[model samples]
Target: MKRPGPLFTLLAGVVLAGGIGITNLVTGTGVTPVAGAANAAGAPSATEAPRTEPPKTAPPKTSEAPKSDAPARADYAGRVEGGGASVAVSIRDGHAIAYVCDGKKVEAWLQGVTVGGKLDLKGPKDASLAGSYNTAAVTGSVTAGGRTWRFTAGPAKKPAGLYRAAPKVRGKASKAGWIVQADGSQVGILTTDDQSAAAPVLDPAARTATVEGALVVAEPISGVDGAGEF
Candidate 1:
């Protein structure tokens, strides 16, 4: 029934406020630290280093290599005759052919004879004449009729020899023998008696001997005969 004093009203207000505060704490209803909200505020918070992909790597570059080349070859053919002897020959791809004559004059009369080996003039002994026919341009010494004769082929321009027979006193005079040319000069008769002593000759000036009834035909070598491969 009586009016309350100011001090009393003030004390009542204070008590009411304190009671509300205590109730709020007990209920756990006030603002609290959120699990990820701190970082949202632009504060430096525990964060994974910016996941960055390694700078993109470049592929390695490759280089090209150079190619190799092949060797060169020769080209030509030739023949030789002397001391009732004859040889048919040809040259191709560093190979040679020499046809041996059974009889001295028989080789000269045949068209051409081709041998079955290489021709090389630079070898020790006659084996040098085994491969290729480059000897068409070589000069050397030869033995014929028990004498040594110098010979050259290709461009030395020297006569090799001469052939003659005795006048026929009875029947037709048979082919007699050869007159050899030696050391830039002409020499003696090449008889069967001296045939064994004769050596192969290379005369550049000697006329290309003709095979009486023969013909020379050239055959291509296998592999190199056609357009060569790469």
Candidate 2:
């Protein structure tokens, strides 16, 4: 049939467009992008934010320790029966102080640190004492004032221990206090109104020293009451 030219052209355009649309629908050839999907093996998706975890950390250290207490310190004093001498020792914290004397022939004072049941003491006049110690007994020899005595000491009884000299110099405002120990040695300092000085050497047998031109006579007094009696 002969038709108008513009009308026939419009109908042909509609039919062609409809046929293409129906072909796409029937063949299922159209594709649309998904909202969210996995990307490459390790890459993140466009619509999703990346996820992360916090860093790992170690545990805190503790301040307290087990079995922290150390060994106990002690004091010991005794007499040497063979030599008729006396001894005394005091132990504190990690330090030790000891004295030995016969109230006549020997006297000394020992000081040192206690470690591994051992003691080494140093005193005035280049004196020294080396020995081992335990709670029940302290067996050691003290070398002082050019003499040495091997002694085993325990608890002290009355009238047997340490002694200090009771001697004063005339005209000096300061008196001398000496450790007239049992191992036949003495350590002291002399003080005067003007100044102080190391004590002069003394004759232990006489208990006298020529301090500042005066014959300083000192009586031995017991560290323990009545100790220097013999």
Candidate 3:
């Protein structure tokens, strides 16, 4: 009998292995052949991964100023009753001032911000006044020293809006001032080279008066400057 060479024996072994792999595939044994089976060996493949997408991220949050549906008025003055406290508000070029005081005590020099059809004024000592108005009158409240009071004011008078005057006595210069109260009263002072006087009581219906034989008048303020001192 003739015997097969070593090379022939090796070829026969490979054929038998391939036949067994084919049989395993046809029988659905779930077994993969070792030849050309890099994935089955748990090795990384050159083909791209499943191509998964990244997760989505959310947008950032932002803070902005509040919007209003009310129209803007340049100058305003308001008052609250019962407390005898009053407010003078002025606005120009979007800047404003609110002065809350009794002209004697319990006063607050509040800053005014341009608020719609309404006025809001605050001060350095935690005093504040807020209200709404038209060309005729203003109504609002003032909060100062932990208390809040309500008032209504008008615009047809002096010391209620703006006042400015320069008097000359015997060619000497003097200064005078007056403010109208929400209670239909007047508060004023006169300053000369030597003295200053208290608020003069005047007829609520009059804008000019004679005090100590001195002619006094209260003028309307038409401008605002962030609660500029009286």
Please give the CA lDDT of all the candidate structures: 0.33, 0.59, 0.59
In model 1, state the lDDT of residue 141. 34
Estimated TM-score for each candidate: 0.25, 0.40, 0.43
RMSD of 2: 13.7
Model 2: how far residue 44 lies from native, Å? 70
Residue 174 displacement in candidate 3 (angstroms): 15
For candidate 3, the TM-score is 0.43
lDDT of 1 by residue, 81-161 (tens): 343332222233433322223234222211111233223332112222323223344233332223333333332111332
Name the runs in model 1 displaced over 4 angstroms. Answer: 32-37, 40-51, 54-214, 219-230
The better-scoring model by TM-score among 1 and 2 is 2
- Score residue 160 of candidate 3 by CA lDDT: 52
Error of 3 at 92 (Å): 3.0
lDDT of 2: 0.59
Worst 10 residues of 2 by lDDT: 221-230
Alpha carbon lDDT at 79, candidate 3:
55
Candidate 2 lDDT over 30-103, as tens digits, reads 64545444464556877668788888888888777554232345545555446655566666566766665544
Any idea what lDDT model 3 has? 0.59
In the order shown, the candidates' Cα RMSDs to the true structure are 16.2, 13.7, 10.0
Please give the range of 10 consecutive residues that has the lowest summed lDDT in model 3.
221-230
**Which structure among the candidates has the greatest TM-score?**
3
